[model samples]
Target: MTKKHVHSVTVSTLSDPLPSVAAKTKKTHSVWREYVKSRYLFVMLLPVIIWYAIFAYGPIYGIQLAFKEFHILDGINGSPWVGMENFKYLFFQSPDFWLVMKNTVLLSLYHIVFGFPAPIILAILFNEIRYDLFKRIAQALTYLPHFLSWVVLSGIMFIILSPTTGVVNYVMAAFGLEPIYFLGDQNYFRFTLVISAIWKEIGWGTIIYLAALVSIDTQLYEAAIMDGANRWKQTLHITLPCLLPTIAIMFIFRVGGILDAGFDQVLNLYTPGVFSVGDIIDTFVYRMGISQMQFSLTTAMGLFKNVIAFALVLLTNYLVKRSGQEGLI
Candidate 1:
């Protein structure tokens, strides 16, 4: 074949490859541009990311202590490795572990049973109230306790439950009954924890449901009324239907956190006498890590709690997804 014909043939083959290469280059540049835009937003988030990385994620390295001897002198890095020893101690050697765990679980369960539905009822009640001023007042009153530090809340409980100058004792005296030390009694301590938790945070819980209730179309309620449905029927047929998904999502979160067991409240409210009933994982950690300075043991307990919570989140999410519902993706 002639040299020109060979050259033309070579150019024809080369032309197609040049277009493909140009398209690939354009795609790479486009991706790089988009990545730059995303990086700008990521840069804006850097401060919080760094803070959490330093403080929050940094402590995650301490989780290794659960597997190590964790000498205070050696710190986390130089600590001697002792695989599963801390966990073994926690389960077998520790005297109060089960008792504390039982109390924590029971308290959390009671909160779920009695306290879980309390906010839903309160939301419905608030929704039904005709007077916006009264509704606002009730909402504010309920949420007020959530702001109070556990230290302050415990003081309030102490006053109310005290044998002397306590309103409760005063009422018991009027009824000719002996005064009871509610805070001091082991039997009452768990009850007090659950009830106080409900009282403090139930209003805050109601807020989300209230927001969901607000999102629900008023026309649905009006249509129910026009269809000769009563108030209760309207709630059953319309209000509840709209609230179910929200309730489910919230319930999953509650269940996922079942093992958490209200550390601050229990720690503040508990005394030596009622420690049997009120002590929990968080309090136990404080006792071991702070009061006792058994850092390794405390680390083990914390690691256990986190591992269980992680598993629960995964399981609950799976079940929710299997049920064909949207959950924490």
Candidate 2:
């Protein structure tokens, strides 16, 4: 070929993409087509996407306030950066910080110890129930409290747990015992919080475990029975093994939020008398940020809490996987 012709051929060859590039372009086109085909599903998901973008991810921008000396006149962007001063104050200077941390950790541990297994046991008991009517009624009764907001529930609790005129005290009186201040006394407040939390959430928590239970193969239980396994033995082997993955995932989530010790419940239920035991990080943050207007300080507190929570989630996930279980990675 002539020099110009050869040059033209070389130019054409150079202009065309290589095989890998062409394959990637083709894959992109295929994905675009799939997305177009699923446009209706995308439309259905748009609101949820918007909600997370707005409420969840959007607020992440304000996390910088944790490091700033935030002023009301000066917005978050206008605030002067403090370079971890707020965190220093939180760790060293704040007197209530350690107290609240202790309370939060203890309450969380209590929930994990007492509250976490409650739903699983309840769900297993529910599975054992042959009477559909009774099961449904029990479930409905347990679930009713979950539907009520903490404000309303606190009112109900106040009436139910009142020292003098309450039904509990009345029952105690029948046995010639002194009326107890469950809500007001610091000693009893934590116990009251744990019990009420369990009572409120146990049924709602069971829904997931119950759903997982449904997905377990009935034949496994039958096989266990054929092998001379009684009801308890069947649960021990068949039911529990089937429930392990779900339990691991749920436990990871629970541990991730170990710092969140029920703000609304504590806020509504606790008085100054029980502040030593019942106060938690959330409540402390609320008082600092909203009630007292220590926005920067509270922002730092929140950032600290979220960092610890994130670390806990990662650690828990790692441990779960190490234990040969499915985890929420």
Candidate 3:
């Protein structure tokens, strides 16, 4: 009987590792089968998936240039590895790095504060306006800026804000004030970019919020009024609350694109004088990568921007989750 008991214990010990190994195999098989079952959907996504593979994922293999001395003929794989030499140069020796970073971050923050809320406010205001014709006209005028290429707008801006005889300067001269150099002044050029960006985009930006607002239940407003809630009260309690998710989503997207300060705007509007303030990472990349042939250095900067953007997206997603809003994650 004692021998039989020992033999049963030995059997139990022998089977212990098999359960875990079998469970792992089962899980892997199930996952693979599930993925195979979704093959039809993946086939439908083939074009976009292939496009991204070629355009997006394929380019990622070159990011090692940041750590190597890049060469055209050598390509990425054949390039001699230099470690963090490029990054060190950018941080310690590059004269423009700090100032450019400062300008980019400050301009981005300014846009977040003013540019982020402009559309939502405009949408809410437009929604509140009772007249139809005025609303349509206002919408058209605001939307027109978005369609106009920044090149045309920049030309118009240059004409209007030209220190020499531009219309805005003319008006200032007529009012007996000094002609302020709006575009040329490094101090004000970033601000000008942010304002112009809002002018061009506010209408289009509001469209999403407007759509969200339209989806709000009419009965809520009716019930609020029946409960003696005034227009302001109803807006505060019902309208604003209904719009929070949309706002949060918009905010997250804006945060994700913080480094993207409109390349066309900068290219068209900037001159040598304002390069101190306007030479952002994108513009810098264009100049260095395409113009100056420092492909590796510019690629490094671009990689840095994307990394920061990726982190910001994650951080914003985290904050959204904490706030109990629907999150990208």
Q: Using lDDT as the measure, which candidate wins? A: 2
| Candidate numbers sorted by lDDT from highest down | 2, 3, 1
Regions more than 4 Å wrong, model 2: 1-30
Better of 1 and 3 by TM-score: 1
lDDT, candidate 2, at 52? 100
Candidate achieving higher TM-score, 1 or 2: 2
Worst 10 residues of 3 by lDDT: 97-106
**Model 2: lDDT of residue 191:** 95
Tens-digit lDDT track of model 1 for 1-329: 99999999999998989999999999999999998979978898999999999999888877888899978887889989999988998899889899888988898899999999999999999999999899899999999998998999999999998988899899999999998888889877777888888899989989899999999999988888899999999999998889988887887898889888888888888889998888888888887889988898988898898888888888988888788777887
Which candidate number would show the highest TM-score if scored against the true structure? 2
Could you tell me how far off, in angstroms, the CA of residue 271 lies in candidate 3 after the best superposition? 1.0
Tens digits of per-residue lDDT, candidate 2, 190-250, equal 9999999999999999999999999999999888888999998999989999999999999
Give me the runs in candidate 3 sitting further than 4 Å from their true place. Answer: 1-50
In TM-score terms, candidate 2 sits at 0.91
